[model samples]
Target chain A: MVSDNFFPQPGGVESHMYQLASKLIDRGHKVIIITHAYPGRTGVRYLTNGIKTYHVPFWTIYRETTFPTVFSFFPIFRNIVIRERIEIVHGHASLSNLCHEAILHARTMGMRTVFTDHSLFGFGEAGSILTNKLLKFTLSDVDHCICVSHTCKENCVLRASLDPSMVSVIPNAVVADNFRPLSQNEIDSRRSSAPGPPQPLGPNDTITIVVISRLFYNKGIDLLIAAIPRILASQPNVRFIVAGSGPKAIDFEQMVERNVLQDRVSLLGPVRHDEVRDVMVQGHIYLNPSLMEAFGTVIVEAASCGLYVVCTRVGGVPEVLPSHMTEFAAPEEDDLVAATNRAVAKLRSGKVRTDLFHNQVKQMYSWTDVAQRTERVYDSISTTRSFALIDRLKRYYGCGIWAGKLFCMCAVVDYLLFIFLEIFAPRERIDVCKDWPKKAVPVAKLGEEEDVESLKEGGVPGRKRNSRHRREKRDETDESSAA
Target chain B: MTTLITILTRLASPPPQTLHTHQPTSSTVTYTVTTRPALTGLCAKLGFYVGISARVVLGMVAVLVVCLKWCVSLGIGISVLGAFWGEGGERGMRRIMKLIEITDGTYIIPLAILVLFLACKRNYKEESLTIISGLGLQTSTTSSFYLRSPSTRFISTTAIQDIFIHEAFKGFEVRFYLAVVVEGEREVVVVFPSMLPRRGILEEVWREGRKCLWEMGEKG
Candidate 1:
């Protein structure tokens, strides 16, 4: 699969790409990655699971969308496609110009293409318009599409005018074991013998509500600003612990000053993902008032950390958690305030089993499950590749009157390129790389044991897996998958 | 209010309509004539334009008059006023104002350039809904200026789309602009810069094909 987004960049899309790639490798696909060059990175670097990444040299114009020199990329990309013998060209992220250009060139070079969407975009805004247009141009001829969630699928359909059927709803998953909740013994030892698990807060205990996302407008920092003063005024004992920073940092500071909440609301700035468990364990509630979300990984992380979640019911947030663990509110200032109040009250009353949320959330998501679902998409598309041609034509047909025709022309061009490749430079000319050590069979069995193990783990079990048998089996799986 | 009280009540208080001497409307002619719908189809036209025109027309014109005197009012007009008129809203008012401003800019800018060579010894005489080229005075959505000439009525035809679309070399594009004339019906204004063969020449051909659109309001 070809993508311009990979490791080093720290974002939801970036993480999604890395995890999905590694998992694909585990499943025994001879997965090689292609991305624009990062500052320090160049050439092919094999990541943990022998996943080869090709960092192509390209102009890094505005926020890493490679300078769109359309035909400039075709020569080098064709060389890579010839070298790797990539049958599938899969691109990730909407804003990546490299991804879009790669899709265009890959189509010209004749390869099946898949695009994975990670964020939700509105029909409004110039950025989305530009993206939608570019997306329309790229997706107009691509084979299949995957989105992190149903909302994201709807957004892709409406944005690029793809058929809902052509686009699969494959929600993003966390390595559930990685996000395990802290055990009572671990918490007690870590808290310096904090007197019997800190005793579920008396009516007077300072309820520390935590916020860990970067404080940006879409993260609903504006709502945070407007709601903070009122919340503090009414709920005196309620304190806030805010982590992460962005343009809204100054606004958050000013709010703290204006309301004299200097002592009440603590701003811890940015925290690393690994340190998230430490930050989260300090608060009774995790507040996620994100204005829009494709899949709220942080809320899941927060729930996994044994914190009752108070989040806005926007984008894919409502679908991520069951109602019992989350206090869902409309993306409104008053609604958020009321929801936070309800969460704090629930926490104070000891009616919520936030302690049990970690195990529950772990069962719902995993990188393995995501990889399995993705494998199905690959099979379905590759197996029915012929009839899927008409399905693609119809999808491109719906893009728009002019755009529809333009898209069909692109698809036809791609088909012609496929024919060209078949005649000259041929599949025989391309040399396939040997597979790296794969997930051991014993590890596969252990993964299957997650259903039972997750329950007994009680959230935090520092059980890391390593087995020789699984690695050998993983290699066999890759050989078969490629064949 | 105190000036009115001093003028009318002398020393006693209460600013009232009767006792005041220096009439606020003294210099202004009070035309109480409710403008009858003079043109047959004009009533509907007026109605269509009212939500947009009420600020520059209805409120001042229902008690219609050509004000012999003019003063600049600094306020959020039509939009805020629309709330009082009990019709549409700030949206229609803004649409009307924006249209008027755009038309004035597009035409007047060229006209003003043409006028600079004219030997009129006028103090930058400007007109309402007037078309002129630049050089003597400047105007646009971000700018408003009086010609040394005293023309009150202003119209601007600011084809901003033309300016931006001219530079774009790659990718498919659509440019939309709307024109509302004080004298004519509102219409959309468009300009196609060039044709992209891979993208297509349809929008370009349509652009060159439609000359009547450049002339005046005949909808496509």
Candidate 2:
């Protein structure tokens, strides 16, 4: 996978790539990630799960995305591809210049490429217009496209004008282990074998609505600021635990001060991703007032933590969870306040099965399922015939009136550059690195024969290896399926 | 300098107006000034100042530095060219002098024509809108010493459909007025208030303006 966002920069994309790559490795696939150098994090590094990562040195201009030095990345990229003997190149995030450049180069080198779009962008903005054109250019020759949500798939298809069938809807998954709720045994021990079982809520008990997101304008901080005072005034036993900080945090603090809600509202400035579950479990409802989102992974994490979600119905959020787990609201102050009120009332009435939410969410999404689906995409691409240069050129020719011609010229130039490199640095001269030992999938007959031999003989190391592999696989399945 | 000022004054000489019986409290006026400072503004990194006095002096110094830098760079370029041509020795200097003497007339006509062309062009006019109490609004503009009489267009507060207050970067505030008549005619009004020495004053004006428009609805 090639992306600008990776480890050491904590974000949704970074977490998604890490989780997906690790799960893919577990499923018996050798995965490597290529990214631009981050501060103090340059050179090759091996992450957990033995996933190789190559951090190439490049100049980053904004938001950690390297400046678009298109042709400059080709030499190093070609060397990595040759050395690794990679058959497919998977790129993530639309705004990543490295991903776009790698996709172009990978196609030039006659390899199957897949692009995963993680966010939504409106065509009305000038920046979006330019980015959409670039997306159209890159995705023109790509084998398949993956989107985190169905809405995102629609958005990607529309933006790139790709065939709908080629675009797949693969939602982002949260690791259930990391976001687990309080177990029954723990709850029982804490409450001294707990009175009855556990009530979701009581009338007199304060309902802490948790909000953990960057306090930015598009995150609907304005709507949040407008609704907080009214929500407090209307609901007497409701409090808020706001985590994460941004430019709009001051606005929130000012609103809290103006409404004199310091006692009721606790601001835990910024919390790490791992600490999110700890903060989330402290609340009964997770309030997400974001105006725009592709797939709200935090809400799924919240649900996994057994917190009822209250989020604005915008940009794939509604499709993320079932109605039972979430209360949807329009992107407005009145609607958000009403939604919170509804969630609070439901919590008070003990109607929502929040305790059972963890198990239900675990069944809904898993990294194993995502990796399996991604593998299917890879399998399909290998069987399909590779597109001719003219066919690829034809796809790019339909991007825009002038953009079409410009893109075709770029493609032609890139193809020529690839041919020149092929002649100059003949592929035969490059040395392929030895692959790591593969846990081969043995046939049933061979396994049976081996089992008999192991029983006849004293012991076999292959028997131990087979048993250990099966145990690890069983453990993974058990942990993933466990609530 | 005297001739430049005279030309500036002549250029701003206002056109004759048909006097009306009703005089408005607020009016708009236009005039011209030298375009040299604006060109200097483009050359320098000096931002447009609203009201702070200290910033104006700093801006002037920055523009002056840019002007001096350009002059010094040009002098160095000419000296370097002269040094390269010094292989011809003293004879090269004499030849250049003769060449200049011969080309002086040829350069004068084009320079004169260019100056005349530039003089015909008017300097940019800066527009300001002032909110007058018990009246609609007044607009005015000044260039050099010439102050042209402003013309006002009265608008009833009842006509205002909506008022939008936009706070730009660095405390700059802009107000947009959307007005619609009962007959379905639409009118738009844009206003930019002077940046005060202190913050919050523009926001105060915005609130007051919004209040006035809303109160007009009650009166209507």
TM-score of chain B of each: 0.15, 0.28
- How does each model score on lDDT? 0.62, 0.72
Cα lDDT tens digits for candidate 1, B1-220: 6565334434332111111112132121111111123335877677746634433333343221111111102334444445555674657656654544445344644554444323222212111111222201112121122224332323333331121111111211111211222223232222211111111222222232222223232321
Candidate 2 residue-wise lDDT, B1-220, digit = tens: 6666456545553332121112142222211111223324543433433223343444454443343334344555335435656755667655644444444444544554454444333333333434433334433333322234433344544443333332111211111221122213432343422211111332334444444445443454
Name the best candidate (by lDDT): 2
Candidate 2: tens digits of C-alpha lDDT, residues A1-483: 999998777799988998899898888888889998776556554454446677888889888999998787887788778878899999999999999999999998899999999999998999999999999999988999999999999999999999999999899998988889887776777556555667767788889899999999888989989998999999999999999999999989999998899999999998877789889988889999999999999999999999999999999999999999999999999999999999999989999989889999999999999999999999999899888899989888888899999989988999988866665554654445434334433443354355434433333343232343333333433454573
For model 2 the TM-score comes to 0.62
lDDT for each residue of candidate 1 in A57-107, tens digit (9 for 90 to 100): 776878766887765566566766665667788889888878887887775
DockQ values, each candidate: 0.00, 0.00
